[model samples]
Target: MLFTPTVIKNLLKKPATRLYPFTVREPFPNYRGELYIDIDACIFCGTCARKCPSQCIEVDKEQGLWSCDPHACVYCGICRDTCPTKCLHMKDVHRKPMTERIMMVEKGEPPKPKKKAAEAAPKAEAEPKADDADKGESKKADAKKK
Candidate 1:
Protein backbone atom coordinates (compact mmCIF):
# COMPACT_ATOMS: atom_id res chain seq x y z
CA MET A 1 0.00 0.00 0.00
CA LEU A 2 1.11 3.62 -0.57
CA PHE A 3 0.85 4.55 3.17
CA THR A 4 2.42 1.32 4.45
CA PRO A 5 5.94 2.01 3.07
CA THR A 6 5.99 5.62 4.34
CA VAL A 7 4.77 4.66 7.80
CA ILE A 8 7.29 1.80 8.01
CA LYS A 9 10.19 4.12 7.03
CA ASN A 10 9.14 6.71 9.64
CA LEU A 11 8.84 4.10 12.38
CA LEU A 12 12.25 2.62 11.49
CA LYS A 13 14.03 6.03 12.03
CA LYS A 14 14.90 7.30 15.55
CA PRO A 15 12.71 9.98 17.18
CA ALA A 16 13.47 13.45 15.89
CA THR A 17 13.32 15.20 19.27
CA ARG A 18 15.26 14.57 22.41
CA LEU A 19 13.86 14.24 25.94
CA TYR A 20 13.98 17.98 26.63
CA PRO A 21 13.81 17.99 30.41
CA PHE A 22 16.15 15.10 30.79
CA THR A 23 18.63 16.21 28.20
CA VAL A 24 18.98 19.94 27.84
CA ARG A 25 20.89 21.27 24.87
CA GLU A 26 23.82 23.55 25.46
CA PRO A 27 23.22 27.14 24.58
CA PHE A 28 25.22 28.65 21.73
CA PRO A 29 28.03 31.09 22.41
CA ASN A 30 26.97 34.68 23.12
CA TYR A 31 23.43 33.62 23.78
CA ARG A 32 21.48 36.32 25.56
CA GLY A 33 19.70 34.30 28.14
CA GLU A 34 19.13 36.14 31.42
CA LEU A 35 19.94 39.68 32.40
CA TYR A 36 21.67 40.37 35.70
CA ILE A 37 23.33 43.39 37.21
CA ASP A 38 26.61 43.71 39.05
CA ILE A 39 25.32 45.97 41.77
CA ASP A 40 28.80 46.97 42.94
CA ALA A 41 29.76 48.37 39.56
CA CYS A 42 26.42 50.03 38.80
CA ILE A 43 26.42 53.83 38.98
CA PHE A 44 22.62 54.14 38.94
CA CYS A 45 22.85 56.62 36.08
CA GLY A 46 19.55 55.47 34.50
CA THR A 47 21.25 54.76 31.18
CA CYS A 48 20.09 51.16 31.22
CA ALA A 49 16.56 52.20 32.08
CA ARG A 50 16.53 54.72 29.29
CA LYS A 51 17.84 52.28 26.69
CA CYS A 52 15.49 49.44 27.60
CA PRO A 53 13.03 48.96 24.74
CA SER A 54 10.44 47.39 27.01
CA GLN A 55 10.88 50.12 29.67
CA CYS A 56 10.98 47.46 32.32
CA ILE A 57 13.98 48.98 34.09
CA GLU A 58 13.59 51.56 36.84
CA VAL A 59 16.47 53.45 38.39
CA ASP A 60 16.40 55.59 41.53
CA LYS A 61 19.59 57.57 41.77
CA GLU A 62 18.81 59.07 45.14
CA GLN A 63 17.87 55.73 46.64
CA GLY A 64 20.55 53.78 44.73
CA LEU A 65 17.99 51.32 43.54
CA TRP A 66 17.88 49.40 40.27
CA SER A 67 14.72 47.43 39.62
CA CYS A 68 13.55 45.55 36.59
CA ASP A 69 10.29 43.83 35.77
CA PRO A 70 11.45 40.60 34.19
CA HIS A 71 7.95 39.80 33.04
CA ALA A 72 7.87 42.91 30.90
CA CYS A 73 11.42 42.54 29.55
CA VAL A 74 12.00 41.32 26.01
CA TYR A 75 15.69 40.49 26.77
CA CYS A 76 16.85 42.54 23.80
CA GLY A 77 20.21 43.39 25.54
CA ILE A 78 19.92 47.06 24.74
CA CYS A 79 19.99 47.91 28.42
CA ARG A 80 23.11 45.82 28.94
CA ASP A 81 24.90 47.41 26.01
CA THR A 82 24.10 50.95 27.07
CA CYS A 83 25.16 50.64 30.71
CA PRO A 84 27.99 53.09 31.30
CA THR A 85 29.62 51.09 34.05
CA LYS A 86 29.30 47.79 32.19
CA CYS A 87 27.46 46.42 35.20
CA LEU A 88 24.75 44.73 33.22
CA HIS A 89 25.47 41.16 32.12
CA MET A 90 23.65 38.35 30.36
CA LYS A 91 23.93 34.76 31.49
CA ASP A 92 24.15 31.89 29.06
CA VAL A 93 21.36 29.99 30.77
CA HIS A 94 17.80 31.21 30.72
CA ARG A 95 15.96 32.19 33.85
CA LYS A 96 14.16 29.38 35.56
CA PRO A 97 10.44 29.22 34.96
CA MET A 98 8.55 31.16 37.55
CA THR A 99 4.96 30.68 38.54
CA GLU A 100 4.60 34.07 40.16
CA ARG A 101 5.72 37.38 38.77
CA ILE A 102 8.55 39.03 40.68
CA MET A 103 10.60 42.15 40.28
CA MET A 104 14.37 41.97 39.98
CA VAL A 105 15.60 44.66 42.31
CA GLU A 106 19.18 45.57 43.24
CA LYS A 107 20.39 47.98 45.88
CA GLY A 108 23.80 49.67 45.66
CA GLU A 109 25.63 52.76 46.78
CA PRO A 110 24.46 55.92 45.07
CA PRO A 111 26.93 57.81 42.86
CA LYS A 112 28.99 60.17 44.94
CA PRO A 113 28.83 63.85 44.05
CA LYS A 114 31.76 64.82 41.81
CA LYS A 115 34.46 66.54 43.84
CA LYS A 116 36.29 68.01 40.82
CA ALA A 117 33.91 70.97 40.56
CA ALA A 118 33.99 71.48 44.33
CA GLU A 119 37.79 71.31 44.33
CA ALA A 120 37.98 73.82 41.47
CA ALA A 121 35.68 76.23 43.36
CA PRO A 122 38.04 76.38 46.34
CA LYS A 123 41.08 76.87 44.06
CA ALA A 124 39.38 79.87 42.39
CA GLU A 125 38.64 81.39 45.80
CA ALA A 126 42.29 80.82 46.87
CA GLU A 127 43.77 82.52 43.77
CA PRO A 128 42.34 85.92 44.90
CA LYS A 129 44.08 85.48 48.28
CA ALA A 130 47.43 85.09 46.50
CA ASP A 131 46.72 88.23 44.45
CA ASP A 132 45.81 90.11 47.65
CA ALA A 133 49.11 89.05 49.26
CA ASP A 134 51.04 90.28 46.20
CA LYS A 135 49.17 93.64 46.34
CA GLY A 136 49.97 94.04 50.04
CA GLU A 137 53.68 93.31 49.42
CA SER A 138 53.78 95.85 46.57
CA LYS A 139 52.12 98.51 48.77
CA LYS A 140 54.64 97.84 51.59
CA ALA A 141 57.55 98.15 49.13
CA ASP A 142 56.21 101.47 47.77
CA ALA A 143 55.69 102.90 51.29
CA LYS A 144 59.19 101.87 52.39
CA LYS A 145 60.70 103.47 49.25
CA LYS A 146 58.80 106.75 49.87
Candidate 2:
Protein backbone atom coordinates (compact mmCIF):
# COMPACT_ATOMS: atom_id res chain seq x y z
CA MET A 1 0.00 0.00 0.00
CA LEU A 2 2.89 2.31 0.74
CA PHE A 3 4.74 3.70 -2.33
CA THR A 4 8.20 3.12 -0.87
CA PRO A 5 11.30 4.00 -2.99
CA THR A 6 12.83 0.57 -2.30
CA VAL A 7 9.71 -1.27 -3.60
CA ILE A 8 9.50 0.97 -6.68
CA LYS A 9 13.18 0.44 -7.48
CA ASN A 10 12.86 -3.34 -7.23
CA LEU A 11 9.91 -3.36 -9.62
CA LEU A 12 11.74 -1.25 -12.24
CA LYS A 13 14.54 -3.77 -12.83
CA LYS A 14 14.51 -3.99 -16.68
CA PRO A 15 10.96 -5.50 -16.65
CA ALA A 16 11.31 -9.10 -17.97
CA THR A 17 11.94 -9.07 -21.74
CA ARG A 18 11.81 -11.87 -24.28
CA LEU A 19 14.35 -11.80 -27.16
CA TYR A 20 11.50 -12.60 -29.64
CA PRO A 21 12.16 -13.62 -33.28
CA PHE A 22 15.59 -14.87 -32.23
CA THR A 23 14.47 -16.65 -29.07
CA VAL A 24 10.87 -17.41 -28.18
CA ARG A 25 9.89 -17.75 -24.55
CA GLU A 26 7.60 -20.67 -24.00
CA PRO A 27 4.25 -19.55 -22.63
CA PHE A 28 2.88 -20.76 -19.33
CA PRO A 29 0.77 -23.95 -19.43
CA ASN A 30 -2.46 -22.02 -19.18
CA TYR A 31 -1.33 -19.00 -21.15
CA ARG A 32 -3.61 -18.54 -24.14
CA GLY A 33 -1.14 -17.27 -26.70
CA GLU A 34 -2.37 -18.08 -30.19
CA LEU A 35 -4.93 -20.43 -31.71
CA TYR A 36 -3.85 -23.29 -33.98
CA ILE A 37 -6.25 -25.71 -35.60
CA ASP A 38 -5.13 -29.14 -36.77
CA ILE A 39 -6.96 -29.13 -40.06
CA ASP A 40 -6.23 -32.78 -40.72
CA ALA A 41 -8.10 -33.94 -37.65
CA CYS A 42 -10.85 -31.37 -37.94
CA ILE A 43 -14.33 -32.66 -38.87
CA PHE A 44 -15.37 -29.40 -40.44
CA CYS A 45 -17.54 -28.62 -37.46
CA GLY A 46 -18.35 -24.93 -37.00
CA THR A 47 -18.50 -25.11 -33.24
CA CYS A 48 -15.21 -23.29 -32.74
CA ALA A 49 -15.90 -20.54 -35.21
CA ARG A 50 -19.40 -20.15 -33.82
CA LYS A 51 -18.41 -20.03 -30.16
CA CYS A 52 -15.75 -17.37 -30.69
CA PRO A 53 -16.78 -14.37 -28.59
CA SER A 54 -14.80 -11.98 -30.77
CA GLN A 55 -16.04 -13.59 -34.01
CA CYS A 56 -12.44 -13.87 -35.09
CA ILE A 57 -12.67 -17.52 -36.20
CA GLU A 58 -13.55 -18.05 -39.84
CA VAL A 59 -14.88 -21.47 -40.91
CA ASP A 60 -16.16 -22.39 -44.35
CA LYS A 61 -18.35 -25.43 -43.76
CA GLU A 62 -19.15 -26.02 -47.42
CA GLN A 63 -15.46 -25.97 -48.19
CA GLY A 64 -14.78 -28.14 -45.15
CA LEU A 65 -12.18 -25.99 -43.45
CA TRP A 66 -11.53 -23.07 -41.10
CA SER A 67 -9.01 -20.32 -40.39
CA CYS A 68 -8.70 -17.19 -38.27
CA ASP A 69 -7.08 -13.80 -38.58
CA PRO A 70 -4.23 -13.71 -36.09
CA HIS A 71 -4.68 -9.96 -35.55
CA ALA A 72 -8.36 -10.26 -34.62
CA CYS A 73 -7.94 -12.91 -31.92
CA VAL A 74 -8.34 -11.73 -28.33
CA TYR A 75 -6.55 -14.86 -27.03
CA CYS A 76 -9.68 -15.92 -25.17
CA GLY A 77 -9.21 -19.68 -25.92
CA ILE A 78 -12.94 -20.26 -26.33
CA CYS A 79 -12.49 -21.95 -29.68
CA ARG A 80 -10.16 -24.57 -28.22
CA ASP A 81 -12.82 -25.76 -25.80
CA THR A 82 -15.62 -25.64 -28.36
CA CYS A 83 -13.75 -27.81 -30.85
CA PRO A 84 -15.24 -31.31 -30.89
CA THR A 85 -12.15 -33.07 -32.18
CA LYS A 86 -9.89 -31.03 -29.88
CA CYS A 87 -8.12 -29.95 -33.04
CA LEU A 88 -7.90 -26.38 -31.86
CA HIS A 89 -5.31 -25.35 -29.27
CA MET A 90 -3.69 -22.18 -27.97
CA LYS A 91 -0.11 -22.65 -29.16
CA ASP A 92 2.80 -21.07 -27.31
CA VAL A 93 3.24 -18.07 -29.57
CA HIS A 94 2.75 -14.43 -28.89
CA ARG A 95 1.06 -11.85 -31.08
CA LYS A 96 2.45 -12.19 -34.59
CA PRO A 97 4.31 -9.44 -36.42
CA MET A 98 2.46 -6.83 -38.48
CA THR A 99 3.65 -8.40 -41.75
CA GLU A 100 2.06 -11.74 -40.73
CA ARG A 101 -1.51 -10.81 -39.87
CA ILE A 102 -3.32 -13.50 -41.84
CA MET A 103 -3.20 -17.27 -41.46
CA MET A 104 -2.95 -19.46 -44.57
CA VAL A 105 -6.02 -21.60 -45.17
CA GLU A 106 -5.36 -25.28 -45.73
CA LYS A 107 -8.15 -27.48 -47.16
CA GLY A 108 -8.63 -31.02 -48.55
CA GLU A 109 -8.92 -34.53 -47.20
CA PRO A 110 -6.45 -35.51 -44.56
CA PRO A 111 -3.52 -37.61 -45.74
CA LYS A 112 -4.36 -41.30 -45.73
CA PRO A 113 -2.48 -43.33 -43.19
CA LYS A 114 0.45 -45.01 -44.97
CA LYS A 115 0.27 -48.79 -45.24
CA LYS A 116 3.61 -50.23 -44.23
CA ALA A 117 5.36 -52.30 -46.95
CA ALA A 118 5.35 -55.27 -44.62
CA GLU A 119 1.57 -55.09 -44.32
CA ALA A 120 1.24 -55.28 -48.11
CA ALA A 121 3.47 -58.39 -48.49
CA PRO A 122 0.54 -60.69 -49.36
CA LYS A 123 -0.68 -58.51 -52.27
CA ALA A 124 2.81 -58.28 -53.81
CA GLU A 125 3.25 -62.08 -53.82
CA ALA A 126 -0.12 -62.84 -55.47
CA GLU A 127 0.57 -62.29 -59.18
CA PRO A 128 -2.25 -62.65 -61.74
CA LYS A 129 -2.09 -65.94 -63.70
CA ALA A 130 -1.68 -65.54 -67.49
CA ASP A 131 -4.36 -66.91 -69.88
CA ASP A 132 -1.92 -69.55 -71.21
CA ALA A 133 -1.22 -70.76 -67.67
CA ASP A 134 -4.97 -71.18 -67.11
CA LYS A 135 -5.33 -73.46 -70.21
CA GLY A 136 -3.22 -76.31 -68.75
CA GLU A 137 -5.77 -79.12 -69.64
CA SER A 138 -6.04 -77.94 -73.33
CA LYS A 139 -2.20 -77.89 -73.69
CA LYS A 140 -1.89 -81.46 -72.26
CA ALA A 141 -4.57 -82.79 -74.71
CA ASP A 142 -2.75 -81.20 -77.69
CA ALA A 143 0.63 -82.68 -76.64
CA LYS A 144 -0.90 -86.24 -76.28
CA LYS A 145 -2.44 -85.95 -79.82
CA LYS A 146 0.98 -84.87 -81.30
* TM-score per candidate: 0.71, 0.55
Q: For residues 1-146, could you state the per-residue lDDT of candidate 2 as single tens digits?
A: 57698688988887567676787776688878867777888876567666777766656544565777677778888888778889887766566557645674768463332477646643442332233234545856887999
**lDDT (Cα atoms) of all candidates against the true structure:** 0.83, 0.67
Per-residue lDDT for 22-127 in model 1, tens only?
9998898799989999999998777886677776887876678999999999989998888888999999988999999899999999876568776575477457
RMSD of each: 19.6, 23.0
- Tell me how far the alpha carbon of residue 35 in candidate 1 is from the true structure, in angstroms, after superposition: 0.7
Runs with alpha carbons beyond 4 Å of true place in candidate 2: 1-26, 110-146
- Pairs clashing within candidate 1: none
Residue pairs with backbone atoms closer than 3 Å in model 2 (clashes):
none
